[model samples]
Target: MEHSFHYLLLANQATVHRQLLAKLKDTGLTLGQPKVLDYLQDHDGANQAEIARACHIEPASLTSVLNRMEVKALVERRTQKGDRRSFAVYLTGQGHSMALRVRQAFEELEEQAFAGVSEAEREQFLAVFRRVYGNLKEGER
Candidate 1:
């Protein structure tokens, strides 16, 4: 079990999580924030539900995240036309700039993660990983 792929994968995931936290420290961002920033990079003006679905975040949790972001002046929720209770979220100027930094940070991490691998090896590994993920997803249903 110590040397199993599943065990090693979990360890790698933890390492990546730590690395992400370290990278995000400078931006004054946290885990859920980056997901939202990445989502809003191209989908500015998205509604709460849309952002939640895209970011794989629960609606209730997303509300809190958005509320915190609003406090940071990273996003603003405006009333959607014809919808009094629903709002469309837009990145503030600061959020737009932060989004770019988030993208850069993710790119750098990806590059670092695969620093030594050949393109062919990376492609093959990802293909197998996808297949394994699909199998697990199917088993859940």
Candidate 2:
């Protein structure tokens, strides 16, 4: 029976994420994997650590995802030149194609989610959301 705006906002967020997961599932990717691929699409051949940071994922989690992606032949990790201990990640041809799909999936989701909502309303909502997020994050730092 929570009537607070926070409850409504959280509920909406959960629903949207669930729908996004469903959409991405069709492409054989989990929630986080597409983000990694999307980032790498723009910054190909990035190191594992860089990719993890850019994708807002932990190194261990990125390692697990990369392992799965490697098995799928979507990405390959090669030893960095002059740094045999470090690896650079590169997308295979399959991965490049999948990345395109991932981008399209995200665009479709956004379009569907915002259907019938005017641009001004969307901008105002985003402004408010960012303020709320900042307020909550203030305590963490």
Number of the top-ranking candidate, with lDDT as the measure? 1
Which segments of model 2 are wrong by more than 4 Å?
1-10, 130-139
lDDT string, candidate 1, 9-45, tens digits: 9998787767877888887887789879989999999
Regions of candidate 1 where Cα sits further than 4 Å from its true position: 139-141
Prediction 2 global C-alpha lDDT: 0.86
Residues 19-107 of candidate 2 have per-residue lDDT tens digits of 77787776677767888888889988999999998887899999999999999888999999978989999999999998888888778
> Which pairs of residues collide in model 2?
none
TM per prediction: 0.86, 0.79
**Model 1 poorest ten-residue lDDT run:** 12-21
